[model samples]
Target chain A: MNKIQDIQQFLQDENLDAALITTPDNVFYVSGFKSEPHERLLGVMVFKEAEPFVICPLMEVPDLKASGWNFEAVGHQDTEDAWEVLAAAARKRNVSLEKIAIEKSHLTVERMERMEELFEGVTISRIDEKLNSLRNIKSEDELIKLRKAAELADYAIEVGCKEIAEGKTELEILMAIEFEMKGKGAEKMSFDTMVLSGPKTASPHGKPGSRKIQKGDFILFDLGVVYEGYCSDITRTVAFGEPSEKQREIYETVRKAEQAAIDLVRPGVKARELDKVARDVITEAGYGEYFTHRLGHGLGISVHEFPSITGTNDLELQEGMVFTIEPGIYNPEITGVRIEDDVVVTADGVEVLTKFPKELKIIEA
Target chain B: MNKIQDIQQFLQDENLDAALITTPDNVFYVSGFKSEPHERLLGVMVFKEAEPFVICPLMEVPDLKASGWNFEAVGHQDTEDAWEVLAAAARKRNVSLEKIAIEKSHLTVERMERMEELFEGVTISRIDEKLNSLRNIKSEDELIKLRKAAELADYAIEVGCKEIAEGKTELEILMAIEFEMKGKGAEKMSFDTMVLSGPKTASPHGKPGSRKIQKGDFILFDLGVVYEGYCSDITRTVAFGEPSEKQREIYETVRKAEQAAIDLVRPGVKARELDKVARDVITEAGYGEYFTHRLGHGLGISVHEFPSITGTNDLELQEGMVFTIEPGIYNPEITGVRIEDDVVVTADGVEVLTKFPKELKIIEA
Candidate 1:
């Protein structure tokens, strides 16, 4: 069955009268209409026994139709009460607005209050887990797009590495890399392109600035690209010049931990165990405290999706699940090194999608 | 008093014990720390009778400290219960949590439920409007950053117009503009740079694509830049070659409407009147229906802020308030034209921050 049919069946099985999909990612997955409506309302109302319909801003109706969604679209103007319009549409379809499932993780408190006021007797249940489960396993077509996205991410890393030189600012290198990605037909960066150098790299989520690259400095790059709505994220750290013995040790330790975690990825393995494998490797190297944050996270249409790979999560790794396995060791005063790769679980082993080499490379600056 | 002190006074006046600020922009405005904690929790708790504190992931503690926030930062690890940590912090401050305010517009339904469960006897109220009122008027320091950001945005339009060619794709022109912005020290684009040519420009929020420029095509460029936490937004439609009479007419109508609205910007004028001033101009030209959206919106730290310039809003224009005056006419089959400028209300009149000429420019492609 198709995705919409699968969702309809799920609503029936769960005894939900209808399901309100509002998050842009979930809405795109169901209706093939992608939009970032800032504060505007954009949703797809799927009924168990009635046909599904979409509601969006009036200005987006043409774009919605062009996205190939042929169902009834209820477009509301800025001055109109969108909830009242949505209720009218529901009544027209004769679908009882009782026991509706909604994406609670994404719906804001103000909107939920409005929904409650609109449907006074309705029981609202969260469909976050159900929707995540439906989008977890990758189909063949999704895998194709994912592989292409990963290839583009790898290409971005290659371009960034080549742009690293003495006296160049981190933002300058990032611009060069993104410029090359645009030339390669990338829709956009999966997230903000990160190029943190020296001690700034110690902050994993640091923003790139005008700090010039210098000798004996370690530069970190964490970037990705979106291709056909699928996203790929990869992180790599390289030396600008001959690094010190301590920097080299930290880089090698992170590479080994990342490889160890990747080797532990297969069907029937617990996600938490994979995290422990990487954590233990880093701990054995006496840098456990330096390895902050979770081991990795699931990646697909969104850069960070369901099934987080943390030491506490016990979700079993299954075939067709795609995620990232990244390991890092960061010291604020010294250096920071991270090695990340995208991989898909196979029937027995795992297929590594990102092909960037993880060895320690010192660029002659 | 500073912003935080103003909030403290607001809480006292409203009879609220405390307030929780969770939206990234508000948190940045109050604490001067900007972070995008995807899925993770980041908030600041301010009390009327006690000291304020911040709650964030453990990994962000150092960065939070570096942001010049000198307060108790409650950091929680991934495995820790952040709610329990937050409650402990509240107890340490001896602040009563019986009544609290929150940004209802931004807090998700799931988070609201969590908050309810954490503080069982607390009565929650919406603080969205209060915060907006506080941030509505720009301080002198903010005006300086906004003026610089507006200058950068004008420069971006100039670069984009120069890059127009017969065979260049919309994405190519966008890249050229963004590369120039980054080179000129822009931290980042306030929003995704839009470059829509020909009929595609009819969609005001259309994404840039691989559509190549052609003769007699009207290309719309709506873009902005962020400089030191302030944002600037500007839109201009330029002709690729000698345009037809119809295109020129539409362009002139929009230009006239935009200028008329700008001329109406003075203290004591209603926001709705400014919107009507522009709408009336387009309607007199028999293109009322073609202008499908609002005239413009408030601009500052965020591109779209409070005091929306729509025909329905009755908020009065006040000194120190900054906003945009944009007017557009979109005919799906023929073409689209828009002219926008950022302006700040002065003591007597107004100061147009963006200096790009609104006169129709036909580039020789």
Candidate 2:
């Protein structure tokens, strides 16, 4: 994918010996292999001059080979200490271990200490910013997977809307949506499929429970799908039956806020400007205190990635930058309403990947 | 729960001022509150003398309070720096930040540097070992939850078996099993549900895909359930129809090895002994090298936890210690067969929590 070579070039430019990319997403990004090495070590060690090598669990070596990585691939046994194996692999390169760049945001303190103990006063710098920026701009191939993922998410929302019934629990609807997603070939969800309902929706991060849906309840489905290697997140809140005036107002305010943010997505536009436009929409509606979280986040290989769309982040929206535009108002006394859409910035303007309707739908169950 | 008080007492005994529990599992363990803060921050700061506090994203403050945590629970907005909020909370305790304990295994180097920057030259000790020891022995209440989780896992396996048929994809069977698990009130799977078929089973960590199941194929179902807060993992591989002689031999050898390990679990026995016994059985059967991974891992609130059951670990199993005793043989030339069960070390011997038939089942469809 030329990503490893790019890292090597980055190391040369920064005058670093090497860079250790270990986070599963970054590993997949650097090498064309995807694996979730839970607890086990998985890394792609890229040297400025030497050829890059991928180190993973011994069993995944064959899988890595099948993934088309022509570079050297090393694996460690379950009984062996993976860190020492990783160190030995690096030593074979014959590069002086003086300065190295690691993902300081992902590498644990324990692992960093082990690396230091192995390499001796190796001045460790961060590879986070460089990696984040490189990953921010999506390639054409990534956009294809992302667009497919968005289509699946839109279908999931449709299925979820159809599954809403009189006495069905939140879990039942959630199970139906995920089961349908699996049938449609979504290997996994970007995150846990949240199917929060009623007052439970007031908490932005509420879990799907056995709470039965009833009349006058606002059901919130904040979910995403991972297709190929890309991710798409979309949230749609619909009313079960007839809703109160307060519910409609909250829904309208959130829709306006979300739309405003998406409209401001264009090349050369500061990411924070979009956030302010969305925040201003919700604030002018007198729901400012209720809108608690950030506007949105970047989406790609990782559902939540670089260029956080927050009021504080001043990152400019360059062409090919894909992200989410979500804004919500959560008032426990009334109801919580959130509308989100996956968007990609283009040279001229923005393209909203998720096609789910933003208008509040009153589902007559 | 007196867990917070226990941590405070440990702090006094260890001559440390405070301990920062940032890992989501540890956060849920110390405070009765559970949360996954993603990129945001969530922690439990337990001081020796001052009152402990739970810090989370501002949006989750109400949810934290609802979890019945009476102690002070602080929240930070997305716009505000979470690390600074965490430091300010510690400062409010009025305790000298001379020495502090942190989960070095979970806290990232970036966060550790931030913490060190906040508390100038503070001696940072590790709370990993102490926390691991505390969580190793399950309480009676925890056992109840584990038992329920194990039952759900057994049910999931039964569902998976029933759904396996000719022309059925591995993901189809996995979807059905997970759908039924949700129907039975299982909030989540301990890990990603694995249903590997035929040659795919040869990879111990194979992912379920669109590959159709055929006759003479070894179908592996490695899954778990999370009930309440406890987790249970179980793996069972059955033949789709009449298997080949080699498949039967591998299956029986794995079964025998698993049984031998399960029989060896008891108080005073080293964790490595079980791994060795299982390894010896497979080695005697002439497929020792095929059993690539470790025997299993300790299980509780977290699916994979302390005291990994490997050939090198010498940790002694004590009463109320719960873990998985899984042994498998994955030969890509033939097929993979794994037999797993959740067992707890009792005062006298062991009690297998997962009640599922381990006999080689030939599913004729």
Q: List per-prediction Cα lDDT, in the order shown.
A: 0.90, 0.91
Instruction: List model 2 lDDT by residue over A1-365, tens digit each.
Output: 57887898899899999999999999998898999898889999998888889999997899899999999999998768999999999999898888999999999999999999999989999999899989999988889999999999999999999999988999889888987898898978889899989999898978888899999999999999999888999999999998999999999999988888887888999988999999999999999999988888999999898878888787889999999998999999999999999999999999999998877899996
Candidate 1 runs further than 4 Å off: A65-71, A162-169, A197-202, A211-219, A238-249, A331-335, A359-365, B161-169, B197-203, B211-219, B239-248, B286-289, B331-335, B361-365
- DockQ of every model listed? 0.59, 0.57
- Model 2 local distance difference test score: 0.91
What's the TM-score, to 2 decimals, of chain B in model 2? 0.96
- Highest lDDT: which candidate? 2
Q: Tens-digit lDDT track for model 1 on A250-269?
A: 99999999999999999999
Each model's TM-score, in the order given?
A: 0.92, 0.90
Query: What residue pairs clash in candidate 1, if any at all?
Result: none
Clash count, predicted structure 2: 0
Query: lDDT (0-100) at residue A161 of candidate 1?
Result: 92
lDDT of 1 by residue, B1-365 (tens): 28789889999899999999999989988888888787888999999998899899987899899998997888988778887888788878877898989999999988888888888878989889988997899999889999999999999999999999998889889988987898788888998899999999898878888789998899999999999889999999999989999999999999999999999999999999999999999999999999988888889879999778999889998999999988999998779888899999999989999999888999996
Please state the error at residue B319 of candidate 1 in Å.
Answer: 2.1
